[model samples]
Each structure stands twice: as structure tokens, then as C-alpha cells.
Target: MFSAAAALLAGAAAQPAGAEEETGSGHAVVRPVSGVSPLPADCGEPPIDGYVLNPNAEVLPTVATDPNRPWHLVTVYQQDRWNRYGSNGAVTAVSDDYGKTWRQSDNLPPFSRCNGGTAANGGDYEVTTDNWVTITPSGAAIAASLSLSRTGETTAILVSRSGDGGRTWDAPATLARDDNAQFFNDRPVVTADPYHPGVVYAVWDRVDATDAGWTQPVYLAKSTDDGRTWTTSKVYDFPDNSGVIGTQLVPLADGTLLIGMHHETDTTAATQVIRSTDGGATWSQPTLNVPAPFAVGVRIPDPDNSGDPIRNASLPLLAARPGTGVVSAVWQSQAADGTFHIDYAQSKDAGLTWSSPVRIDKTPVGSAAVPVVAASPNGTVAVTYYDFRNNTADPATLPTDVWAVTCKSNCTQPASWREQHIEGPFDARKVPLTSAGRLVGDYSGLVSVGRSAFTAVYGVATGDSANPVDIHSAIFTG
Candidate 1:
């Protein structure tokens, strides 16, 4: 017999068709994808950070679409958050008819007990974090995550493949694992090569601790046979006490690869990039792209929280125009007055040189977090993020909204951009409160659907503890 949670999850496979809510300017249409069902209470692990499980919350979503079949869309997210670190397990939702409806899949390779994990299957971890999904040119869907024990006993990177458009999944293949106390892996990203048929790359940071301090080095694992197997290598390492995190891989149309990361020292943090010409064989030394004014991995505090804050970061999002070699990056940076703003920079010559960073968020007040960027075939760039500009003087409630900005050409100039309100003005304080803070997610999803329209999959709060957060999608035209 299936558990009550499992039975409910099975019944939630086919979500109802969402009603179209067009923006006032008719530039975008928003749809509800995941519906209002509460997530399953699947993980039996005890909470470590004094916070109870928030089973109604769903956070940290990543999305992708099959190029050969534009109607095939896949989104992976963390469900039933603990308000501290990870989730009960990750959930995969597939939409074959564009964004109209979705089918939630239960085959995610069991990263925890919630997903039928066991020590025999190498999924004995207590919780999972950082869910990412991508579709290859041949319609194969790949999902990746950071699976680890809550007590810091083990940490690993795992990838799973789906051959039938995400209706089901095969057992996940472990890409890298660390059993000792000295190494911890975090912030993994998986990308299928757009030009190469069966090649996919996963990049992350493995942090090592010594008597001096902590040092994190970038690691790369390449799978040439569509994630069946992987060959791992250490691509870059910093000196002791210095490291990097949030590594992102962007494969150009001409077969060149660019990896962008947040390089950090004890007192400084900067956005940096590295290039690989002959695939993953060798890489150039890192080049400093933008020196950040604030720390990279620090979580933002909730304005309404008197005790615990919300868990959010300012990780950089990178994108490259198909054939023009024009690469753009967007991230949240804190100003001198302690306000966070979304910033954008461009690189015309691949990942070598970058233009000066410009403020992209049009909000004159409040802070922004979790910026995501995507590029269309015609070189148009779009960036999406959430801001607190709608919040009033009420400390009991925090009103938040999602906004998107797009630019066609001359993107370096501040005036060349157009801003549109995608969704929200919801109560941000209604999310799960964790040791890290109240949680929406560390990142959201935004991808180009065609030449001008982009689809974003993101989370929002509903002010109801019984159903706190829900995943929504917005398709907007530049």
C-alpha cells in the first residue's frame, strides 16, 4: 500500500489547466503550474537547526525546455523545506503542452527517505538541495542535485536521466562523493551542450578545511555519453584561505565553453570567468570580471523577521547569445546604503572582457534578490528578480513582486532596457522560516522559448501556513 503522502503525490500528477492572466500592458501572461496542494511529509530525519518542517512550502526551482521539442518542459524544485538547509526531497514537474498544464513525477532517484533512498542505492542522505534540470537536443531530460546527510557525515553530487520526456527517471548516477569530514560539496550546476549531441557538463565547488581556514576549488565532471558515466577533474584551485562558489557553465555555439563563478578571499569577493577551448581538457587561468562590493554567499535578512531571516543569495546568472559571442551576466549587489540592486554586465568577446556593471532594477527603494538571466536567438537579453518595493510600513507583512527587464541592443546603457511586472505583490513573510532564514529559494528559472518570448518558473507565498508557497510560470515577450 502507498503512504498517504505518496498517494496524494500520485494524484497530483496532472495539474489543472491554468487561467491566463495577462499583464496590464499585454507584454506577458502568467499561469499557475504547480497548483495549491501541500507537499508530502516524506523525510523522517530530525531537524538539526531547531526549526520544524514546513511541509506546505516548495522552493528552489530550476527549469528547462527541449530545443527539438519546444512543447516539452521540465521543472525541478525542493519540496517541504526545513527552514534551515535542504528539503524532504526534490520533485520534477513535466509540461508537454507548453505551460498550460503539468504532470508531477515521483521518479527522482531517491535522494532521501522521502524518495525511497537507501544506503544500497547510494542515496542515504537525509535531505537534498540545489535541484537543476536540463534537456538535451535528443529530448533526454537530466536532473542534478547536492545530496548530503544533515549531520555532515556525507555529501555527494548525483545526476538522473529521463528518456521519456520526464514521465519517469532512471536511477541517478553519482558524479562525485566525499565521505570524510574535510570535504564538502555545494552549489552544483549541470548543462547539456547545445552544439554537441551527447555531451553534458557539471561544475561545483568542493570546500576543504585546514588549520589555516577553508579553501574551495572548482571541480568539473564531463559525461560524453548522455550522463550514463562521468570522468571527473579539478579544473581550478585557489590558494589556502581563498575559494570560489556558485559555478555556472555556458557552452557557446562554436563549441567553446565558459565557466563563471564567484571567487572569494577572506575579505573580498569578485565575479570571475574561465575559458575552455578544447572542451574540458584544459582551462585558462581565471580572469576577474567584476569586483563585487559585498560578499557573495551571504544570506539576506528578512525585514519582517525579528529573529530568523530569509535564506537568499546574490549568485550571478550568465547567458550567451547563440552566434554573436555576446555574453551577459546579472546578479544582485548591495550598495553602500545597504540596499540590494540587480546589476548587469556584458562581454562582447566571449568571456574575456566585460563592460561596466549597470543597475537594472527600476525600483527606487527596497532590495532585490535572486537575479536570473537568459538570452534569445536574436541576442535580446532578459533578467528577472524579486524586490520588496511593494512593502508598506507594516512589519507584520512583507509585500514582494517579481520584475523582468529586457534589452535588445546597446544593453550597456541604462536607458536601453524595458521593465515589466511579471507577477506577485504577495506576502513574502508567509514562507518557511529556517535557521538560514525565511525561505523562498536561493534561485529561480528564466529561459528563452523562441526568438522574443521567455518563460520564468518561480515561487511565491500565499500568506497561508497550510499552503505557504506555490510555483508559477510567466511567459513574457521582449
Candidate 2:
């Protein structure tokens, strides 16, 4: 179920409990997940759906810091089956050089199966989506969670932890132990407080029935000790369908927590959430922060086509920190010329508010979809957009590149976005300062060598398929 590198990483280190390989600012001592030197046959599965979400895939890479070894970068990924029949779990990789090489976690479930079920043709139903990863200061542990596929009608809140680097992990535990699950959950995100490395917070969509398979309302939960246990979750009841949704966590240098999400109905949606002085223990009412556009589309499976005219998708919270919680987010909208444009936004307040929505590109035009973001130590925010700016003319043409934009203090350069397709096969992006002012995007997300370079991991594309995405990384200087 793992690639050669992942199996090797697990075998390479028989670390003592609480041991960690050092680097900088709590990053994993990562080796590239798949190297250009020639992929090992056992590296891992190939890309799927012409997209990153494989039946058993790892996406949404995140870095966490360790207090004692503040140099190790431990990254975590949300793993499900390569097709759609696989269940939920996490796949982990670590970096020693700052976001480069990757090794899959051994002992740990390659996939976090909060709910067990047989995989039919690698397709499983009712599993987790959008997992958030974080690390503890002592370099003693790692934590994260997702919307677990519990029993009937229950999109349960699930959390998991790892001790001694990323080699092995503990079983996933639930966030809300009580019996008040009124709504279904989507996207579970976590952020460890800078001041209190032991403190962690998670925010997610708490809906009446996201069973419709879209987005809905939101709620939050907090943990005072790593991710061992969680407090009861509280739904942030909003005023109608136009409520708070798309929950993400951003912790400040002083332990303050900022939660960002989208606040709008079908016609008035915008990117926004809230901030908590006492962690997720309490939160203010929904705050109307950043402006982002959310569009709806449909996909009908076809046996004779290379593409769907309307492929619907949305981005969850990327990465966050203080003064720069939101770097980028994506949604679809129509340009003045009546073409669909993928719009993005960055937030500085950990989602308390956000910059205006910037249109990256429009349809010929088709549009961009599933955008994500990361914060750079140098104060730059890196954004990754899966672009299809030329798809209107050729349905067989897959997105040629995953592009990036580096911005500081809410960059709103609409005209600057005109220069598109600066990168490749990447689905994710992150800014690692030790590597320099580089902007990294991914077919996958990983970087290990350039302490001063931004790195990305992505999967290689061999042909056009519905699952055309996988994990790979590259480094760049912003």
C-alpha cells in the first residue's frame, strides 16, 4: 500500500520514543516522495482521476514544528483509496532538508480507517475528506483529524496522533464523545498554538445534511493537550443557509486562534470565519471577512469522453499563521466577458478577515478550481491554482500546470495574474523560508534541501485519465 520511499522511511528509523530528525522550525527531514532520478517501482500508486484525489491518495500536505527540535518539518497527508471506494486514514512523510524527500510512515495505517469497510474496486463509501496536520513542541507527537465515516448518517469528527517522528501513529479518536451530532461534518482542520505547542484547535462544517455532497454550516473543537483528547464541539449556528462554512485553523505567535471559512448563500458567499481568545472553547459570531466566489457545476460520468463540461470542486483551508492565516482559496465565477474565472483570496488575520477576491484566470475559457495556500517565513503567501484557462476549446486537454502567486499583506494585483502558468503538475504549494524567497507548487507537496527555497511535491502525468493527479514536489525562490 506504500511506495518504496515510504517503506524505506519506516524501516530507516527505529527511533526511540520521542525522537526526531532535526532541520528547522519543526519541519520533517523529508526526502522527495518521488525523485526525478527515476521512480522506484514500489514508490506508491500512480495519479488518479487526472486529479490528486486518488482512490487511495495522499493530498493536503502540512508542516508542524517541534519545540525542542524546532528544526524538523513533519508533514502529514490525507489518504484515501486511489479510486473512490477506499476508506479514510493518513499517510505521513518527513523532511530533513526542509521539504524535499519523503518517506511514508510504517506502523501507522497507510489510510486512517475510522470506519472499516470492504474496498470495491478500490472504491469505498463514506470516508474522511480534508485532514489538517499539526505537531507538538517537545518533538514528542503529531496530531490531525477529519470527517470520519462512522455508521449510518453520521459524518463523525475523527482525530489521530503520532509519536516519535512520522514512523508510526496512534488510532484515530473522535472529537465529540457525546451524542449530539445533529449535522454532517466535512473538512476537519487543526492548528497548534505557537505559544502553547501542546494546544490544538479544529474547525469544520457542521451541517444538517451535507449528505447532498456539497458544503454546509460549520462548528469547532479544541484540544489542550496535543490531540490525545478533544473537548465537545460547538456548532456556530448562523442565520439561514447563508451561514458560516469552510472551517480552517490559524494560530498566532501568542497563542491566539483564528478560524476562517466562507460566509454566504448561493449568491452572496464570501471567505470568512472567526477568532477565539480562549481557543475553540468559545468563538465570536461568524465574521464577514474575505471575499471569494463559489460556483456550482455538475459532472456526468462518461465512457467515451476525456473531460466533463462542468467539473464541480471547491478548496478547503490551506495553511495559516498569525498576520497571514489565509494565503489563498479558490472558487468559480464569471468574468465580465461571460466566461468562468477561478478566483482566489488571502487572509492576514488567521481568517478573521481576508483580502478581496482576485481572479487568477477565466474560461476561454474554462476556469481554475481547487486552489490552496501556504504562509512563508519571509511573510510571503504562496497560492496554488489548478488552471484550465484554455479548456473551453479542447475537452481532451488536461490542466497543463498548477500555478503559484507570491503575495504579502493581501496582494490584489488583478492585472498581474495575467502572467499565468509559471509552474507545473503541482496540486499544492508551500513557502519554506530556510529555502529562500522561493515559491513552490506541486503535483505533490514536499521539499527537503533548500533551507532558503520554497518547495512543492507533485505526481507525474503519464496520460489523460479521470484520476490524473498524484504527489510530487519542486523548489523555487520567490
TM-score of every candidate relative to the true structure: 0.91, 0.68
Candidate 2: deviation at residue 66, Å? 5.2
RMSD of 2: 9.2
Cα distance off (Å), candidate 2, residue 363: 9.5
Each model's C-alpha lDDT? 0.77, 0.47
Name model 2 segments beyond 4 Å from true.
Answer: 1-71, 78-89, 109-126, 140-152, 177-182, 209-217, 240-242, 264-268, 285-310, 316-355, 360-365, 389-394, 408-410, 414-452, 458-460, 464-469
lDDT of 2: 0.47
Winning model by TM-score: 1
In candidate 1, stretches whose alpha carbon ends up further than 4 angstroms from where it belongs are 1-27, 35-42, 48-51, 297-308
lDDT of 1 by residue, 170-233 (tens): 7777889998879999888999987888899999999898777999998998988877788988
Candidate 2 lowest-lDDT run of ten? 430-439
